[model samples]
Target: MKKPLIFVYFFLLISPVFAQMEFGFDDKDAFSPHSIRQVRRADVMYNNTVWVRMDLREKQNEPFFAANSEITKIIIDAVKAGVLRPYKNDSLITRMSIQEFNDNIKIPGADEGLTDEDLAMGFGDSDFGGGDDWGGGDWGSEGGAEEDAGPDEFFPNNIYILELKEHRMFDRKRSRMYYDIQSIKLIIPGELYPTGINKELATFSYKELVSNVFVDNPAAVWYNAKNTAENKNLADAFELRQFTGKIVKYSNPKDNVIDDIYKGNLKLGLAKSQEYEHRLLEYESDLWSN
Candidate 1:
C-alpha cells in the first residue's frame, strides 16, 4: 500500500512535464496574470518599414466602396485641424484640363525655348521643403547655429511633424470612386538629422529614412513609447481616422520586400478593404490576448 501511494505521488508530479512537452511550451504560448512580457520594438526608424499607398481617384457607386471616400474626408479634416500634416511632395502630379492648361499657357513669354508654365507643368514644388522647422523654435542668433544655440536648444529642437508625402488625385474618368495614397513617407524632424562635420549641411541619418505610416502601423521600427488617454501617441491619433486619401494600386509594390508572398498579390486587391478590416480586428484581439 505504501509503495503504491508513493508511485501515485510521483506520477502526479511527472504527468504535467510530459503534457507540457507534448504541447510544446513557449514564452508566447504561456500566460500568467501576474507577469507580462512587454513586446520589444526598435527605437529609431528606417526607410521601408511599413509603407502603404491608397489611391482615391476611382469613383464608386453609393454604399459599395464609399468607405474609401469617407476615410479620405476624415483625413482631410484632420489636416485642416492641424492634427495631421500633408506632405507637399514635389513629385506629386496634378492633372489639368486641356482648356485650363491652354488658358494658363497664354503668358507674356510666347516661345523662346520653353516657357515657365511648361516647366511648371513638367515638375512642381511641394510644401515639404526644409523651410523653418515646423515647430515654432526661435532661430539662432546672427553669429551661427553652433555659436548661438546651446545643446539644450538643439536637443529637443522642434516638435515632430507628421506628413503624408505621396498624395495624388488625378482627374481621371470617375469609373471607380476612390482615393489613392500614392506612397506614405515618415519624414523625421530636420533638427534630428546629423550635421555634417564641416557644418555645411545636415544629412538625414540612416534611422531617419523616409517611408512608412508610422502612426497607424505600430509593429514597424517606429512604435516604441507608450501613450495614455491623457496624452496620445501617433498610433492613437491615427486610430481616430486622422488620415484620409485614395488608393492608387490596392496591391503595394513594396510588399515584395517581405517574406509575405501573398501580400502584394494582385488578385487580393478586389477584396482588400475587407481583408484589411479583418486584420484590424485580429490586431485588436491580440492586444488583450497573449
Candidate 2:
C-alpha cells in the first residue's frame, strides 16, 4: 500500500509535464488565465534582438498593395529624411526635368531644361521670379533668408509648423479649461527647396500621418521588466516611450479654479469665451461647410 501511494504521487507530479510537452498546452484551448502563446506578427527582425511589427490593413486593396512597394519604401525613406519634396507625378517629372532644362538650353547650372512657367508650375505659383507670395507676408518673415532668431521664432526654419485648428468644447465645465484636438494642417514653407518644387502638391499632411481618432488602450510597454527579471537578469531593462496622458488643456490637479467653473477667474473665462467663439467660427466655415 505504501509503494502504490508513492507511485501515484510521482505520476500525479510528472503526468502534467509529459502532457504539456506531448499533447501541447495552449491558453485558448485550456482557457488558462496565465498561459502565453507564440503570436505570429507581420514583420520580424532578429539581429541583436528580436523585433516584431504588425502591418496596418488598408481600407482599399489598392492602398494595401501600394503600401508594400519599392516606390513606397523610397517615398517613406525620403519622408523620414525630411528632404522629400512633395509633388504630383506630373510636377515631379517637371521638377526632375529642371536638371534637363538647364542642360538642354546649355545653361551651365541647369538641372533640367525647363521654362520659367515650368519652374513656376513646380513651385505652385502663377508667375516666376521673386515676390511669388512665398507665404512670407508683411506680418511674417520669408523662408530661407538668413535671420538671427531664437529657436522658437516663427521664421521658417528646417522644421515646418502644422497649424492646429481650434478645437471646440461643448461641455461648459470642460470647455472652460480643456479643448479637443482639431484638424492639424501642415505649414510647408516655400524655402524648403531653393530650387523650388510644386507647393500645391503637398506630400502628406500631418492629419494624414496621424489619424483623427486616438488609439484606445494601446499596449504601453513593449517589453516587460518583470519578464527580464524572470530570465535570470540576462535581459536588460526595457526602454519604453512613456506617454504622459493625452494632451489636456487644464491639467493642473491642485488648482481649485481649474475644476470649479462658476467661481473661475474672470480673465480665464473671457479668454476661453473668445477662444470658443473663434473655434465655433472655424467649425462652421472650415469643418462643416458644404
| Model 2, CA-based lDDT | 0.28
Worst 10 residues of 1 by lDDT: 198-207
Best-fitting candidate, scored by TM-score: 1
**Cα lDDT listed for each candidate:** 0.29, 0.28
CA deviation > 4 Å runs, candidate 2: 1-159, 173-176, 192-290
lDDT string, candidate 2, 37-92, tens digits = 11112111110110111121212112211222212232232222233333222111
Name the 10 consecutive residues with the lowest summed lDDT in model 2: 45-54
Candidate 2 residue-wise lDDT at 165 = 26
How much does each candidate deviate from the true structure in C-alpha RMSD?
20.2, 21.8
Can you write out model 1's per-residue Cα lDDT over 151-244, one digit (the tens) per residue?
Answer: 1222111212222322112112221111222323322233444541111111111111212122332221112124222333333433344344
Which TM-score value belongs to model 1? 0.23
